[model samples]
Target: MSGWSDSGWGLRMQSWGEKYNQSNLGSPDCVSSSDTISRPTLWAEPSPVVPKGADVTLRCQGQRGRNRFQLWKDGELQEERNTSWHLAEFVLREVDDWRDARSYRCRSGQGPLWSELSDPLALVVMTGDFPKPSIAVSPSPSVLAWTTVTIQCQISSQQSSPDYNFALLEAKSLQVLQLQSLSRSQPYFSLPFVRAEDTGSYGCIYYRKTPPYKGSHPSHTVKLTVSGPLPKPTLWAQPGLVVAQGTNITLWCSRPSLASSEEVTYTLLKTGTWQPLRNQNATDLWTDFSLPSVRPEDTGSYRCTYKDRTASGAQSETSEALELMVTGSLPKPSLSALPGQVVEPGKHVTLQCRQPLQPELWRATFILLKVGSLQPLQSQRPVGTSAVFPLLSVRAQDAGNYTCVYKKTFFHQVSEPSDVLEIWVTDASPKPSLSAWPVSEIASGTNVTLLCQGPPWTTRFVLHKEGSMDIIQDEAKFFLTRVTSKHSGRYSCSYQLGTNGSLWTQHSDPLQLTVKVSSNTLLITLSCVIFLLLCFLLLVCFCHQYIPRAADFRGNSFRRFFCCSCLSQDVCLSHHLEDPKEETLYTEVAKERPKESSVPIDKDVTYAHLNIKNLNERQTNPKETSTEATLYATLSLD
Candidate 1:
């Protein structure tokens, strides 16, 4: 409006007509042209980044012109203007960002002497991606093996027709794993049937489609983890996780019915590291990894994974973590169900747990537990590792599993649970039984141990010899470190409940611990040799009798009884029972016994007489009787 008026209308019309013809002419259009024309330069305000449906300005500027300007988009006429200053700006409104209607050019004229068209300028529409696109996995970072997952990569720019491409890469290995290109219609990728190897962190990048095709920096990394498919094993720590220094505890890893009878190997793993703590191949129902002694450094989270020969021989999924909160400053003590593990209903049961400790820890606070329960049943600050929890008149409900732990009042540190112990309150805690080993006529001097066995529930025991009740024992086995004749007395044992030692059950049936003199090997050998010599002499005498002596020399009935009795009374009594008059002792003794004595005492008769004598002596003095056989000397003056 401010420039020259239309007073040059005739000239302007002539100029417009001539300029329009020149505008059509280009370097490519002319084979050989006449007049040279100076061209106006064309450019866009913001290069290559025009947004869709946003207004854009294409300007053509040069020396003051005839004020006639025209704009063309991608070889098509857009608009024309008669302008004011030496510059002409053609405003393009509502231009589509991705609609290829972008390339533009302009021409300007000053009557009759018009300039050729300006250079073509291209505009690219973009929203964002000035930096890079961000990619993220849907659902969660952790996914189960063999499941589908979705990863969405998003750039701020939403181009109608995208000219930028995106590439997804694995951040872990820095591998170029393209999920999908941003230039594509869809930017999100679905990972179907994911696997262990698929677990890793990922990132995405965007690049231009134009020449040079520049690429932006990678996006922030996203983590994805895939867990294997397997039944997790059960993990429980014996003597518990929080423990004292030098305390031995076992971590039991169990996969019951699944293991069948085949042996399985179990490995215990700690968090923050791929390495395992220990492993053991177990043939039994469960495998155990023993921490023979734990130190403060051993505290951490623990889990167990195992592999068996059968059903999915591969290692199982890692079990849930069991936090080991070791505190050496805390006190640890042993736990036991005392008097015994089994107690009769209406009997006092004492759970006594103790561990040896220094005198400094005598006042440690103790806590007893019926596992799976949070509250401890017994809490006492005892003097020493020993903690006694007594239940009076225990009922069936009182019977269950129990364990204990200790803590110091000052630091509030706690020890781990002790080994599991069971309290079995049953129908009249049955009396324990007794038995001897070896099942033989025990040789004197050889060590003989009488086992006093009770139920697993019972703990305390007292053993009594038949004659002496004053001697008592706390152990189940009564070992006569050495045995003599005096030890041949009946023994019985009694057990009780409660640490208070207020009550006891009936005594076990008596078991006699017998010792014998027959154990003397040299005496036995000498007796055998003498008997053989006597037999030979008797044979000679008998043969001599056949030559010239009386009938009394050839046969004497008591001979058998006398000769066998010389060995030992126990042997004599045993043989005497088989027959009264017919049983003989030795062959020589049977031949000479009647000749030696005027009384015709058979083997049985002699045994009966000896039994009578022993009975008499026992009744009178309670002392063992000694027997002697009278041997008469037949002296021949020859």
Candidate 2:
């Protein structure tokens, strides 16, 4: 009976299996419960869990009835193979607090018969907050009141989200003073008009508020300091003095007690022109501008200003204004003489100086100096345009160089001195007149004296002849020995008051002299006397040799009687006695020969006899005694 009961139980278990098998075979989707076939299945499983920076692994297992299986994680399938189970293992290489707290899962499958999804598991990545953002303030070396300040924050992470927000906090109070959102890892913040109250210790904090919100720690702190305002500036002329018209004037701006590197600019207000006096980079402490050529038109009040740059790119207040007054032009002076001419020495002369157009507006002064001498003859402040120095008796010392100077109403300004005027006094000594001594022709080898006569009492004289000059200190004459023709020509003389006197009179007119040989007139007279005497003696001798004694006897009674008696008595008596007495008487008369010759006389004998007698004796001699005498008388009558 127990065997029959066991058999019945076995029959019942077989019948239940057969029915279960028939059901699986009829449903094709039930793969794992059906016959074993090689096919793939896919499903996911939970990821592995790990601490921060720890390594971890995940596994996916397949059922034995499946021929092939694949591992999956987060709905993504991994590599597959024909095996009873598929396994996937993962190692968490590094994890932070943020990453370790994330969720993970895994799955497995083979073809269409994939396994059910695995349960989800929490992953502890074990990460802390983001590293502190680096923060800095610009103009770190120094800070000033009312200046702009900039704050910069940065994060040194490549993976950080672009939507990170940053906030600057006062480190001492931990109060947020400023906030900013950044699309990049680093961002900058700026604040203008920073004052002393804004000075403090400051830092920055950053965070991301997207799907997963995270915060960052605060950065290192920086301290800020602030200073006071700039000082006031003052302006004035460098050297306080009256400036001449058309001259340059310089003004300076200064802040004696202030120390700053800020720039200074100057502006001069004159004739409606506002000139700029600064350059680029504008940090210079002083500036200068020439007035070029100042005039009365440039006279006005002047001022200066100093500017320091602010955080907002604006200017500061100006400095104090300075005042200046410019004066007018001065007068020009001149010098002249009262008579407007030079005077001779020993005569009265007056020297004068004339002030320019505005004489009454200026104080005039005069000075007269001899050139090359230190002492001035006259110096005075005249009342008007003209000043006179009346010299009672002009002398050598009175001739000199003269000059004039004058000043305007404003004593600080003066006019240029007048051009140098020269006043020369004519010399007093009279010029000596030159003349040759012995007022006749000069001869060679003889001493010649040249007399130079000056005004009665003159002491010194100078003689000039041809090319020669001689000085006669105490005398007024020049003597030359062995005078030659070469020494003959124009000669002149000059006289001075004294030997050493500078004054000298004008030269005298020249005197002319000629030189020749000596004693010509007497020699010519002697030659004429000798010639006349010889002619007279020859006439007397010619008369004596040719004249007849009978011509001579006609003028003398004694010689005439002697001749007649001889002829009548001797010759005629003898002849008559020889004749008869009657004839002898008549014949005697005829025989007497009429007391004259009937024979024609020779002209040579007549001329000779007349010539033989002396002119004085011929008138007294007897006549008619001889035939020659008769011829002579006839010749004389003819």
Candidate 3:
């Protein structure tokens, strides 16, 4: 065995061994044999230190024998193969503070068997500062009450044999809340029931669990804010009240949560139906819904909801339902009249209509029509229930039928027409005129009819005859059955008016009706004349004796004699005319000659004296003649 070195020690050992053998052994054989036998030598190379993470190789060479080489690191053997010339290499995979600087050696089995350990291989790995841990919240900034949220911390670089510790801090107060060790590069922390007071900025710090426990920079901060619950809402109505049908109604929705500058949309609900009101962007406390025309079907309970433009969520609450009741429609009406269906012209008539129960909301109108025609005679609206139509002087045109109708305020409903009424009018009749059919030839017992004609409008004709009290009334014409002496009279006719309480017209011009006598009638009249004459003769005879003498009382006896002679000449006339005259004359004579007178004498003497007196007066008036004297003598006869 020999020590390993790079110097020439084996040649010096041969020179000295030859000189010592010549002196000590004193034999030529001893010197020659020692010089012929050889000695072993050893050598090592590249013995300086190497840097960490650098590749290193060791080699061992030996002389004059088969040798084995071995390599060692920090007193521990590394695996290698046997050979006289040996070589080994290694790469440094990791280095720490203590293991970064260490020595390595190589040894041989023969020729002194070992080499001194090599210089230290100092490894200085390039180290830099760790990156800051990144922090983040799970649900961003929105964390509700009693809800869990996650916080995460992550390091940029990882180590092979890494150990990690984590610390959490509030950014506002710098107060630590949690500290723990973890083996992973990224760690997570859970926070629950975050309150308003718990709301703040937060950050995390991470470090490796080594000798120095070097910490990484803090993460970026994040902020969070918590809010409370919203307030309740209210709703109401506009115009504040409801009334009868056809009235306009309005409803309003309001809320206290409405901000002055915020817009709000309102929804009006009725019986599960929803409607949007006007002014959806209004900030006022209420919104309105106008119902221009309301009816019974429109009535219902109502509520509302509101949404603010700036609110995170909609605020809503149900209101007390308001009940609306609307009045119903009016009823149909009825029309009537006084003296109902029958009316007379030239008289007063009244029409009436009865409205429904609500009379204030309705009115009536009357229409008068011709019986069979659609043309209206009159149309009128009366303030009261009854209206009167007066016909002062009625004519045929005034007669007609009439009816009435009633209507509601809105004109949407009307009543059936009233029962029809009829009117009748009348005109005055004319006087009738009469005429004889045959002018000059009417005989007794002849059949004749006195045709009495009146006005065409006359309903009844009345006939009258002069000097008679009987009246014959007929239609238009009058007839006399037989013409007789009794029927010979003036005939006339008149007409009767065909109206209530009407009077008859005046009588017409009279017509004369003459009857001629027959031959038998003429004979009977002559007989009557002869018989009356005979009766007169007998009366004259009886009155003659009673009469006194006329000559004794007469101063103008001749004039008297002539009148008596004229009367005596016609005995028949004397019979009818002389009796009353003779009586009157005798009365005068008897008065002239009283019974006590002395002048009394014989009849002849009285007569002579009268004759002498008459002669004397005749002589004085020569107009007297002898015929006159004879008339005197005849007058003296009783």
Best by TM-score: 1
RMSD of model 2 against the true structure: 49.2
Clashes (backbone N, CA, C under 3 Å), per candidate, total 19, 50, 3
Relative to the true structure, how large is the alpha-carbon lDDT of every model?
0.60, 0.50, 0.48
Candidate 3's TM-score reads 0.19
Candidate 1 Cα lDDT to native: 0.60
Where model 2 places Cα greater than 4 Å from the true spot, the runs are 1-350, 354-381, 389-638
What lDDT tens digits, residue by residue, belong to model 2 across residues 1-638?
11121221110112322322221111112312432333222111111222245554444344555444444433455445565434444444554545433333344455676655443333323124567778878877257877777778888876357566565655643433444567676777675656443444677776552312244656888766545434444556633222446667666554321122334334434324556443223444455545645565454445555444433232333455443333443444566665533457677767666666663554554444344543345666666666677777778766666655444322334444465766555553335677878763687668888888865536677787677765656678778788777777778888764334665678898888776654654566777788878876765454333222343433224333443344444543344235443211111113344555788756533332232334435567655333323132224322
- Reference-based TM-score of each model: 0.26, 0.20, 0.19
The CA lDDT at 24 in model 1 is 23
Q: State the displacement of the C-alpha of residue 106, model 1, in Å, after optimal TM-score superposition.
A: 93
lDDT per residue as tens, model 3, 11-78: 11122222222111111122222221222111111111222233333343333353555556556777
What does the lDDT read for residue 53 in candidate 3?
Answer: 38
* Per-residue accuracy of model 1 over 1-638 as CA lDDT, tens digit each: 10011111111111322332222212212312333356766655432234456676666776664588778766777887777787777776776544533556677777766677666444544334366567788787787878878777776645423666554555532333332334454486566666543555677655554433344556788877666634577788877655567889788887533212345678899877778888888765567788877776666678997765443354567888876545545545677655677677888878887855677667777767785553357678866568788889988788777887776544445565677887766544567887887642487777887777876645678877866754556777767756768878878887766554767767889887778766367689899999999998986554323221122333333333344434455554454354444222222323444545576545433211133445667798876554643223232322
Models sorted by lDDT, best on top:
1, 2, 3
Clashes of 1: 19
1 against 3, candidate with superior lDDT: 1
